[model samples]
Target chain A: MLIERKWKKWVFFYLPMAVFIVFTLFPFYWMAITAFRPDNELYATWRQPNAAPLWTLHPTLEHFVGLMKTTAFPTWLWNTMAIALVATGISLVCGMFAGYALARLKFRGSEFLGTAIFITYLVPQTLLFIPLADIVRDLQLGNTPWALMLTYPTFLIPFCTWLLMGYFKTIPKELEECARIDGATRFGAMVRIIFPVAIPGILSAGIFAFTLSWNEFIYALIFMSSADQKTVPVGVVSELIRGDIFFWGQLMMGALLGSVPVAIVYSFFVEYYVTGLTGSVKG
Target chain B: MAIVTIRDLNKKYENGFHAVKDVNLEIRDKEFMVLVGPSGCGKTTTLRMVAGLEEITSGEIRIGERVVNDLPPMDRDIAMVFQNYALYPHKTVFDNMAFGLQMRKYPKDEVLKRVRDAADILGIEALLERKPRQLSGGQRQRVAVGRAIVRHPQVFLFDEPLSNLDAKLRVQMRVELKRLHERLETTAIYVTHDQVEAMTLGTRVVVMKDGYVQQVGEPLVLYGQPANKFVAGFIGSPAMNFVDVSISGDGRHAETEGLRLNVPDRIRAHGGKRLTLGVRPEALRIANGSDEHGFATKVDVVEPLGNEILLNFRAGGAPMVARVDPGVRLKAHESVRFAVDPERLHFFDATSEAAL
Candidate 1:
């Protein structure tokens, strides 16, 4: 019976888990292998003898070196970093205040407003970019980093607000009330008590916003026209794959490098991110 | 000087729930006043209104001599301990206790001294550097209390502060809170649904039901001479037994199924009228044979508690329990006679359910 149970456990849990891990991670593994494979091997047909399509005998850094030397990858990385950071900061501040107000304050239309904000978040960015493009052009922000930095918050704010609002609700309201009675004003209580307690939620929201803005495509593509002003995702796709010909090695190299910052960010706050999403406050 | 007065207080939510109705109270300096009732009885709502945490629909609150109706909680010089303690999870015990003093911009050394002093009194001086999540429930309670006492506000508001603790810890904290009140002498208004806590902790207890004040008096006075049926039923443990009975034509005796007792002379005018009679469990005793005034009934269940025994049986066609001497042995379904003092009887008008 115990042996059967163990066998069942492997089939139901571990076997499926292994399949899922490979399924999700196989793309990244493929990217790394292709980026490191020599040009001759990468282009070689699988039908050729000793072609080794899956595994390469020879690995080289030529793709990474060539991509950096020939393209505006460095500028794209810097632009993505600067835009995502500013955009995340802006969204976090707005979301914190809006979320707190929606969660704690008792104003007329508060529930209606909460649902309305969430509805705005549900509106697809695909449809929003057209009208936003017109506005961005009218504001004379096109072809500059300001265009993406300002427009990224349009969706980022609502996402952050909804997440942080749910998080703030999980924090006991009594903490703020006790603070108010302990001599702090309403605003003071929010800043001192609610905000500090909500750091985990805020960090999670910020990380999400950073990742979203970092990997954002449509807005960065539409707003930034200059080679140096373009963000990583748009820059890589636009610059590397010219005409119908694809620079598979360079493209894969760019993909791998573009994700490192976000990976580091996620790793740094992974503990807080989990707790924030789960919305657990000790008191 | 720190007397807190509440006049004609009312709270009606936008959803049209009338939570508190024309409540009036005066909490004297150095007095421990408790507002108690079942859930939704407006006890916590009334306390929150006084704490400025809830908006009062119409009321005037005065702290000291000032009419503080428009004042914020901080300006009113009041502090509150919530049911969940509401300690800042990120802060150490010292910071939690010192938060109020620091907010008021007290000097650095003075804040430290006051926090240390309050922590010492609560016997939590050893745990000052730990976070609230690290402390036990009882320790967190002390820290919450310490936070309130460190400020020495004009009045302290406790919203069922001990309800979260286990029963044993609750009892321990109750005595400690009472002793703390005696030592500090700050006017306080505490809210709870537990009758025992109200009776033991409050110098004066206010009983509420359905958004109305049922009775406000000393715990024993509320117990002995309750203003109405609700007060009488709510103030005691095991509750006062109520039986519907009709008075006999002689203007002296009241009768019901399986029970007969004399109506006190003061309420004899209720003769020939259907009324409700109430008797507390402790008032009944096992009667010896040949006791003319005793009523005979079969015991349904005998619970022999160590110090006393509880006899459960049907009286007036309703289940009733009697507290009696543990020395007298009894068995379920066995015939027994029980006697009650005439003065211990309580009569209420059947229609109004008001004490007669």
Candidate 2:
């Protein structure tokens, strides 16, 4: 009877979870194997004697070596990291103030202003990049990391603001009022009491902003022309495919390495991210 | 330790909600003044305005000798405890208590001493290192109160600080709060919807309704000689039952749907007019057979509350509760009669609701 119960539990819970894991991991498995497979094996027809599309008989690190040594992959990585970090920092500061004002302050047009900000977020980036591209050229910032860094906030700020606004709303208004009555000014209350209490939410917004900017593509593709100036997404796509001749191994290697940073960020702050989204400020 | 004077204070929200209208109050030093009312009755709004948390739409508020109409909350020299406790969730009990001193630029040693003193007073010394989320509801409320006391402000404002606790804890905390008020002896303005809290904790109680101050006086005065039907009803448990009655043509009695009551002689000038007759549940008793001026009623329900029995009965076409001896074995649907204390009968102008 116990064994039957255990079997039923496995079928109901573990089986579906294992299937989902495999389904999600299959694409990464294909990417990593292709990155390691020798060029001959990778391109060999299925009819070849030793050809196996799913697995490689002899794996090599040549693509990884080539990606690092032959290309400006390091420079691109540094550029992407620097631009995403700076943009996220700028967006977080602005979003914190804007979110607090929209959520707490009773100013004229506050509701209208909050709606206006959310509307800006709903404007598709595919269309925004056109006017943004023109502005980038006008400022002579094309081919520079500044182009992406400055433009990323146009969308990231709105996203962060809305997220943080929702988070700020969950906190009881009496906390701030009590702080004020406890002898802190409004700004002081926000800095000492509210910000500290909202750290999880802030961290969540920061993570979201970082991940969004890290994986951003359209603006990076339009603005940066230099190999070293490009972000991970634009750099790998632009450099690995020359006139329709794809360097599949190098492409896959770049993709695999490029995603590791974001994955690391998610893993380290996953608890904070969940709490931030749920926004449990118990007082 | 300061007198708070509010003169002609009014509050009108931007969206055109008149939350408080023409409220005037003079709270003496070291007095515990409780503002009691139903929800949306402007009691909390009036307290918030004094704390400077809500902007005053008109009139003047003076704390001591200074008019604080334009002062920010930090400069108001008052602390408020909210219903939800409102402790800083991220801070430990010690830091939460010290935050006010630190913000006022108190020296480090002084901040520690004051916060520690407050912790000691509140008996939360061992919980100093624990965050608010780690504490129970009652403990968090203590920390919230401790945070307020550390500053030694001139006045303390409490906004229903015990409404969150369970029944047993609420009684315990209520007693503790009363004791704390006496020890501190600071002027406090408390707001609560619970009439029992107002009666027990307040030296003076102000009853408000619909943005208007209905009555303000000592708790017993508000209970025994309420200024209006609203205060008479709002200031008691098992609220004062009211029935519409017309003064009889004889000039010394009143009549309702199915009964007649001897109108107290003091209200004789109101003869031949419609009025509201108010009587508290405790002022009623089961009538013995020979009792005069007793009205017949049918027992609807019997709620035996250990010490006293609350007999629900239909009298004069209205449902009412009469507090009687618990030994009275009454059952539902039984016929009974109750006699009210003639002197305790309240007469109010039917149209204005003002006590006559």
Best by TM-score: 1
lDDT of 1 by residue, B286-343 (tens): 8876556778899998899899888898888877889888788889999988888788
Query: How high is the lDDT of residue A196 in model 2?
Result: 83
Candidates in order, interface RMSD in Å: 0.6, 1.0
CA lDDT of each candidate?
A: 0.92, 0.91
- The window of 10 residues in a row where model 1 chain B has the poorest summed lDDT is B285-294
Per-residue alpha-carbon lDDT of candidate 2 for residues A78-136, written as tens digits (9 for 90 to 100) = 99999999999999999999999999998889999999999999999999999999999
Superposed Cα RMSD, model 1: 1.3
Encode model 2's per-residue lDDT on B1-356: one tens digit a residue: 49999999999998899999999999999999999999999999999999998899999999999999999998989988989988888788898889888888899999999988988998999999998889999999899899888889899999999999998999999999999999999999999999999999999999999999998899999999999988998888898988888898766888978888887788887778888888899999888877798898888888999999998887777778998888899898999888876898998899898998
TM-score of chain A of each: 0.98, 0.94
Candidate 1 Cα outliers beyond 4 Å, as residue runs:
none
> Worst 10-residue stretch by lDDT in candidate 2 chain A?
A176-185
Q: RMSDs, each prediction?
A: 1.3, 1.9
